[model samples]
Target: MAPIELKELKDQLQELLERGFIRLSVSPWGAQVLFVKKKDGSMRLCIDYRELNKITIRNCYPLPRIDDLFDQLQGAMHFFKIDLRSGYNQLRVKEQDISKTAFRTRYGHYEFLVMPFGLTNAPAEKLYAKFSMCEFWLSSVAFLGHIVSAEGITMDPAKVEAITKWPRMTSVTEVRSFLGLAGYYRRFVKVSHVWPYP
Candidate 1:
């Protein structure tokens, strides 16, 4: 780690400790720490939880469908895009599960008191009901990669641009991957049904 990043990591750890989000741990489990560069060029601390996630039971909670969420917006004249800051931190780790979320930093080892991102079973739906931190829009808003409004949904321009510039598929796997991505926005395409791969 660079000296500056090491300092930032220590500062972040201290802040988390002060906020009661994490505590000193002597758990047998330890996951790796990751420092991701944020848009502002600051380090965003992340935990590499792949090994833990492999052992954790998957949460089978059904997430709301994007189509259904858009359906609910049909009659609404206003839209509020809720952005949860440190959303995962808002949920508590179960008493028995806290040790499982432990990770080591250069400073020391610590475990999360709150749920952290990258956990397989961390259901986020309940967090939406807890806060009003959001931006209000009069008619339309970009959501789940689509611009939605009372006027109806349209593919976000960026998504359309991606589809346009998608590399030509040379392999079966690539074709499947392209189809899977394009299929997500199939509603935006005019319905001339038959698609034969030429």
Candidate 2:
């Protein structure tokens, strides 16, 4: 689908503001827009930019090296993970690329007021900076024990073992491999007396 014009996008933003679905905030990076619900109880305008991200250039930022990560974990045996809430939304995209990042949805097309995922340079320019800054701060501030970067909270072995014991769970590797070979050669291999099918 084609992108919406700037005029139309602004109109949509205005309507959302009028309806009290969003509030505007100013930041050093740029305009930071946030979603707010109306008193009557309705959702605010939110943009989804998955498609635009496909065409944008990805920022080239080097992640922590494996050796560095391992070194940090040397004395740690247990780990817990936490995900930042709306991490990308905290960033602001460059002014020049804002139009290119406009998105369409059922209600209307709208541009992001803050940085979003799937945009080119979003990872390196915004995400990396925020994450690296946090990492730096954590490293500089000493803690009782090491806290490794993880995507989710750590669970005890008993909880994990209970999940493995779920009913109907079965191994299918042998069955899948056998069926794969049979299907692959079905045209050449036939059931016959000479074939001695098993």
TM-score of each: 0.75, 0.38
List the candidate 1 regions with Cα displacement exceeding 4 Å: 1-8, 36-43, 123-133, 166-180, 191-198
State each model's CA lDDT, in order: 0.86, 0.45
The C-alpha local distance difference test score for the whole of candidate 1 amounts to 0.86
lDDT for model 2, on a 0 to 1 scale? 0.45
Backbone clash pairs for candidate 2 read 53-118
List model 2 lDDT by residue over 78-134, tens digit each.
454334545566666566655555554434444555665545455533333334324
| Clashes within 3 Å, all models in order | 0, 1
* Residue 126 error, candidate 2, Å: 8.0
- For 1-198, candidate 1 gives per-residue lDDT tens digits of 888888999999999999999999999999998789985897888999999989877877787888898888787777777778788898998999999999988899999999998889787666743356577765888888888787788889998898899998889998888888788988877874758475
